[model samples]
Target: MVSQEKKIKVVLAQFPLETHNRGIITVAGMLRDAGMEVVLMGNARAEQIIKVAVQEFADVVGISSYCGGELALGDELLTMAEREGIRDHTVFILGGIFPPKDAPKLKEIGFSATFPPSATREEITSSIKSAIAARSLG
Candidate 1:
């Protein structure tokens, strides 16, 4: 039987190195409320994907890029996960100011979902829940 506490490991990747950590924190709180274990990342880092995953024991990673480097950043995260043999276990999500043209490309690169800045909190919450459910089913 599943435990009453549903823990969802999450990583929030915001960009450039400065700005309010509000979005990350907000989503983290919501996930936690939904019984998830959330791990958040700030700014950009080549090594942070693996590092954060290892540190968080993440089931999923939420990468946000307000900066212009989201596509490359998201791919790097997925590549790191694949190399570490963690891909099968981690669901990847990209959020923030993504260029529409690059959206499908990011998905092609392995992001399970993409959310622009306007995406609602409820949408994100539902997405997380759906990912968790899908992971369990698969």
Candidate 2:
């Protein structure tokens, strides 16, 4: 029914359910401008996010959490990724309101990339490229 286009399918779970969500819309636009398929899942259920990611066969997942719960949620997300068997192929990126000091902690939990707040679009793009490059090398 629909056309199959080759684009970087992304699910943006970046932003609290109560916020205006303009930031995520902007970020999604940027990724779209870069020729990547972007899906904005504002305040979606965790299981739904996981289900959609698995069903869509998304190439990347972008989570945005700025609150204190990111630590716990991040860990749970990694666990969900593993359960879905997309841990290796999907590009796992976390963005928004992140503290740089915790990068190691997220990295340790199998996150392929982390984009803290104030990070430029180029930085995020570069991270994805780097992940692709690294995957190719290994």
TM-score of each: 0.81, 0.85
Candidate 2 C-alpha lDDT tens digits along 78-107: 788789788788888877776778888888
Error at 77, model 1, angstroms: 1.4
- Per-residue CA lDDT of candidate 1, range 2-99, in tens? 79764667876664563656666766777777676666667657466677776778878887666576777667777888888888777888777757
Q: Provide the global lDDT of candidate 2 against the true structure.
A: 0.76
Backbone clashes in candidate 2 total 1
Question: What's the lDDT for residue 46 in model 2?
Answer: 60
| Model 2 Cα shift for residue 132 (angstroms) | 2.7
lDDT by candidate, in order shown: 0.74, 0.76
For model 2 the TM-score comes to 0.85
Top candidate by lDDT? 2
Name the runs in model 2 displaced over 4 angstroms: 1-5, 15-20
- Where is model 2 poorest over a 10-residue stretch in terms of lDDT? 14-23
Best by TM-score: 2
lDDT of 1: 0.74
